[model samples]
Target chain A: MFSAMIKKELLLVFRDKHALMALFVLPAVFILIMSVAMRDQFSSKNLEFSLFVKDLDKTSMSQEIIKLITNDKHLVQIKEKGDAQFFIVIPENYEQNSNEILKLNVQKSLKENEIEVFKSLLSEHILKARFHYISQSIELYSGKASKILANLEISSDKLYKVKYKNSKKLPNATQQSVPAWIVFGMFFIIIPMSTIYINERKQNTLMRLNSMNVSVFAMTFTKSIPYFLINQVQVWIMIGVGVFLVPLFDTPALAINGSVLAILEIATGLSLAAIGISTLIAVSASSSEQATTIGGILNLLLGAVGGVMVPKFIMPESMQTIAEYSPMAWGLDGFLDIFLSGANTQDVFIDFIKLFVFGLVCLGISMIILQIRIKKGL
Target chain B: MIKISNVTKTYGAKKALDNLSLEIKEGSIFGLLGVNGAGKTTLLSILNALVEMDSGEVEIFGHSLSKEKTKIKSLSSIIPQHLAFYENLSVGENLDFFAKIQKASQEDYDKAVSVNALKELMKQKASTLSGGQKRRLNIAIGLLNNPKVIYFDEPTVGIDPKSRNEILDSIKNYKNFGITVVYTSHYMNEIEKICDEVAIISEGKLVEQNTLENLFLSKDNKSVNIEVVYSNILKELNLKLLDETNIEVPKEQLCELLATLEEKNIMIKKIDYGSTNLEKYFLKRTGVEDV
Candidate 1:
């Protein structure tokens, strides 16, 4: 009976292309896309995109500014304005005319933050050129600029070193995105889980099973085992995408410095948590549409609050505190501990316990609701 | 044999089943007939253990329903009004899964499959099956373990006439195999066609329990049902409103009732004369006149 039930559940999920996409493909895509897109932010690198410079200023100062900004590793100073996401126009005689300001034209689609960072970098470089001329007490664009530049150390990037407690490896985009999305994807088991469960109830299959003497607990157990395994598979596949595919786009591949077993434990805990809540949702809802709606809203809210869409460090302090309360946060933190901090099973054991207990409580409540509904013949 | 003694169930202020007792003999197809909300489902649920009677003693095949629920459950299966098989699975897979749950032998479901004529659709996904085929699969599932008793909860509510007959024929066939069938439906025609004995419930109380033959034979042979349409002219006379916009009176009073209605400019709608089947008996017992 157990084997047949397990097989049936497995077939039910696998045969549903939509469920497979929700559980597997969507997360894999998110992991790849998010990791690549977040590369610059996590790596402390300048934004990478096309830039166009229209240097109308015929002065040496404008030439110097153009040289410095173009020298950035990620920015390419192109001549075509159409190709450039950011077009900078150095006003004519900017060094001679004190009233003139540099003008920058940007595409509407450019991310606001990246543009801000680029603007700051441009200002910083311009100021450094002005300070050099003032320190030398010479007129702007004097040939003496090269003489001073030869002796001065203009780069300050190395002065501030990013450290992660005692860890040597730098945390990168893949590290954050891989774990966060895996946790997010694992919870989507609710979608398919709620579907099958709601169908079972609406069809009176539950009553039929009861007549066959199959306990609800037995049914829930059989359902959980398959979904838990699916979650594990989902985690590994997304990790494979991060480890093997994300790097092809120049983003750093995911590095799992923690024990693989520990990661699996965290994933397992998350799977249980997801199943528990999904069961509750399924039991509470009257139809598949209702289950999907409730489950969808809940997953999105949880993901948003749990640092799945945005890293906790980026959130305000109060928001971070709230993130700590989301079960998804518990799972994400557990994975991050291993992925970024290289912690082992022992380090994430508490997180696992938190998730496990939450799952059990949900399952307990769900079972209670299910019992009430069954007795009430809902 | 099955016996329900003084079963009472309540939902808030509504009593769904009030001290209802019944006896269904072994190997007899007993039909529980009633109108909507007549506690037939409540009784079926009680028998299937899907519901708990507020107070009652139900014994099936000499097994106490409460004390030996698992034993009783193993002895019977229900064909619910709703389809219950897994639509994602093939018919064979669903059968195999339920068969496993019931600990049924290969020959058990093989016989069921053959009886239900599902051999060709074995590999077809259940969702793709037609309505009649779906109903057949439902019965085949209940027949998996060859339970001593089977409960049908309005299984043929909506379907083509051919499919309904096919379902009825299969349900009646289970009796030849010595399985006690307890069928419930509001459709009196179906009960008349297949049921040997019937228990009519109204407002959670049993109005009648006897063989279908005895149930009609024992009714007033001289009296029949007189139905009418209402008009303001006949509003002066007090009449029993068993159903909305309908009334029933004994056949002996048909002329007087018609005369008054005709004199009052009211028209006679239907007069069920010289017939005493489960429909009229059920209508008479439940205080409902066929519209």
Candidate 2:
């Protein structure tokens, strides 16, 4: 009986072209458009800050320091004055006098955060050059290179390294935009699901089913199965768009670095959670109009608060705290953990559990509402 | 067979079914007649176990409805007033889908299709079918379980005359297969034509219950309308006037009163006998003329 009900629901949904478009096409288009449109904001590798170098020392060591500064990925070299945001001055005999510190003069027009980043990058290179000069002097004076290196033993890895497992580079626009919009699209299943449910009630199909030996649980589950499957399909379609379609516009393709099974597991959990929420809205609302309206608005709000509209990293701390309570946030985080952070199944285990629990809770609430409505013959 | 006793259902402050009691024998066509808010729907819902009763004992096929809900549901099918099938699915798919839900065998599906004469339109979507064809499909779905009893709520509400007749014919044919049918409709003529027995409810209470023969045959329940040239004779005779010149007289009292009227030399232009209709009986029992 349950299978038959699900089949009927699937048939009805497949027959609705409008619902199909909303489920599959809308998210793909949005992801593609947003990824291409905001590609620069996501990829910061190409950004460069102008830096003027005044090499007064003119020694080989000073030239070496200049080479290090010019090799910086984020800084572009400027020869003349007044042509850069900041100027680096290597004072006379700066390399000979190892205790002397290089001066960095900046324009007042630079923003405070920009200035900080600029100063940090320049200071890192200068400190590396000084360490190199000291290592060379020690090798020269001791005349035993192996002993001097072993005693110093300093390396760049000691300065900064990730201790956790499965860490990767940050995501570009396509990776973040794909999953966020997919989550948004998955929750929008509520509109169509609620509309179908309300139509069943209005047309007396629910009463008919009741008279046909179908329990409320059976009906709700059967009705929810189709939308859950549709959500999974939506997820895959969006993933496909991110992998194949987004890169066509010259933006970097979304890469999934973690285990594929982990991503699929999270997708399943998120689908269940989304469909459960849709079922609740479908059964609880008074009319189709109210159901669709409330479902759409609730999904949009969840999308906003859950970091789908904007990255949680940029949101206010209080709002970020609130985002933790959203199931969408859990789902988006799980996807990002796999796509951006190279996390495996165990890495996102907590997110998957939270999503599954949230789905069960919503299903429980829907059942309670349905049972009460049936008892009261509403 | 179905029996309902002391069934009372209340919706907030309004009483939808007030101490209602009824019995329907097997293989009988029973008519439930009432106006819009006369609790016809509430009664049907309770009988089918779709709605709970605050106080009642309902037994279907000798099984308690409250305790054996699944059994009762399997034994009965309700054709709702509105279209209940998915419009997007074809007629065949709808029938097959409902048949599977009811656990009906392939033979049962074939039998339903043949009985309803829906063979050619099996591939047509329900939304594309005419009103009467859709009504037929609805009945076919109700018959999927091969239920012993069927509850029909306003089956032929808005349809062409030909389709209405076809549906009426189909309903009447249910008795040939020994299926008990509980039919409700606003069209009194349809009730008078198809029902073996009738029950009239008003204000959530049963106002009258009788077989068609007894309901119309009882002399006190029947009346004759007499039309005279003017109202002077009716005033002299102290007979209540139904209109300007028409007076409603008891069927049994008509002959003696007409003889006395002839003795009084009153001219009788026309004497119209009120037809035995469920409408008249409903009006007389409920004290409301519209329904």
Per TM-score, the best of the predicted structures is: 2
Q: TM-scores of the models, in the given order?
A: 0.78, 0.87
DockQ leader = 2
Model 2's TM-score against the true structure: 0.87
**Which residue segments of model 2 deviate by more than 4 Å?**
A54-62, A78-83, A87-109, A125-158, A162-169, B220-277
- Count clashing residue pairs per candidate: 0, 0
Name the top lDDT candidate.
Answer: 2
DockQ of 1: 0.59
Q: Per-residue lDDT for B47-121 in model 1, tens only?
A: 999888899899999999989998998899888888999998999999999998888998998999999999999
Chain A TM-score of model 2 versus the true structure? 0.86
DockQ of 2: 0.66
| lDDT (10s digit) by residue, model 1, range A1-378 | 899889989999899999998889999999988998989889866557688888898677787777777787767778789989988888877987778998989999988887887777777678766665555554356657656654454455633667665463445799989988999899898889999988888888988887788888888889888898998899899999999999999999888888999998898889888889988998889899999999999999999999998887689999989999899999988888898788899889999999999999999998888888888876
What does DockQ give for each predicted structure?
Answer: 0.59, 0.66
